[model samples]
Target: MNAPFPIRKECPPGACVCNRQALLSDPQADIRILKLTREEESRLLARLETLSSLADLKKMESRLHEQLGIVLTITPSIHEVRTLRGISIQLQEQPGLCRKTKQAIPAAIRRSLEKSPDIAYAILDAHGLWDGT
Candidate 1:
């Protein structure tokens, strides 16, 4: 069966995080998957910490969608205004998505972080894994 979504080279070998093939093979299945490396996760978390308000987070999310063609939902705590830790991101993907769009997520995030003067160091994570839900 053909892969439902393109598998990125960044993902480690044998890392079948998302059963995209199953989703395509079985029309009833509705599952989309995205795998982020450790470095990507760290950079995303650090960038998130720098934001001052939910509005900023929303803006960033909008930018990601606009520039990278990736849709993500950021869950922030309502109690505290400044949330440095304990953040969850829901990356939205769909079956039969184009390969170019799938590959743009990391590059776009990296470019976004490079603009930050404080975030001078950015490395691609080699040992990142995604646990499919």
Candidate 2:
């Protein structure tokens, strides 16, 4: 997916933290499967359960960008993880973000979810993941 913003390197020269070499070789190729531990998955689901509205989830996205320079976009749909029987959600990371920051995005997302118990119940509830029962 194309980044909402223009694609440009966000890191400086010599000491590049944004995967400068790889990005320089191919700026448009940045598809990575971020694996989260089971504990982290549980925590993330727990936090997502607290959200009551889409507005709250939007707040979490903003928080991620503000605090971690990570740009995450929540799509309107979910996919099944065929291997794990778990659901997969879409999170888009824009180019030019530091590798360190990118790696920390999941943890940062969990933190954001903790503060966002007010958004997107209908979305998560589609798969019954947000059911209070």
Candidate 3:
């Protein structure tokens, strides 16, 4: 399957720690997926398993890193009013649900980091995110 969302090639989103270099200036762009219900999940899986490979998983996961929230470390133990802080607060308050992407990240991140200068590898451990690895 093709990527449901766009992956930045030039200025990647993880550029701060990676190598975006002001390449992607997506102000309001969102990486979205069709939230599949239980029935939808079963249906899609059946169709995908019939003719999909691991390459599809890898590509989709790679795109996810660029799709979701950008990497921004929140300064803990100190209250600082900043644009990053605003984003952090909003994320905590109104995070939405995502469907099963069946994609992985660690392998994808490592792959991208080793091969592409535009992609940076940063370790972020969170729930509700699929790292197909």
Candidate 4:
């Protein structure tokens, strides 16, 4: 008797564990690139500008600390005025905070960037991809 042939199972093209076949045929598939409209671009640019200004301010603060021995505390108004967003900057004087507080500053910046209107639009577009938008 001949040895039993091995059984083969194959998935159709465009079909996978997530069953993305229907999604692949979406007419608005190019929406991903198109979602970043001019308005959204401008908003993101504005946020970036604010971030750059904040960086400059932080540098100035550091210089003041070194030259004048004045520790500049980051207040809410100053943060908003500098960045146009309420991003917290970890300071040394604040007790009970982490030792390397400066490391947490980047995370605050990242969180603010993620909350930008342009980023929110991009996230919405990504979610729509699965819905065949």
Q: If scored against the real structure, what TM-score would every candidate get?
A: 0.35, 0.34, 0.20, 0.21
- Tell me which of candidates 2 and 3 scores higher on TM-score: 2
lDDT per residue as tens, model 1, 1-133:
3434543233343543444454556855432333333455456556655654445656777865664345775343334323223223456766533344344543444344445422222111111112242
Q: Write the per-residue lDDT of candidate 4 for residues 1-133, one digit (tens) a residue.
A: 1113321122345442322233234553322222223454345335433443444445645753563233445433322233424433444442111222234343444454455545333333343423653
Off by over 4 Å in 2: 1-54, 62-70, 75-93, 111-123, 126-133
| Whole-model lDDT values for every prediction | 0.44, 0.47, 0.31, 0.37
Cα lDDT for residue 12, model 4?
A: 45
The alpha-carbon deviation from the true structure for residue 125 of candidate 2, after best TM-score superposition, in angstroms, is: 2.4
Worst 10 residues of 3 by lDDT: 86-95
Report the number of the highest-TM-score candidate: 1
- lDDT for position 112 in model 2: 45
lDDT (Cα, 0-100) at 52 in candidate 2: 48
Query: Which portions of model 3 miss their true places by more than 4 Å?
Result: 1-34, 59-94, 98-133
Q: Number of clashes in every candidate structure?
A: 0, 7, 7, 0
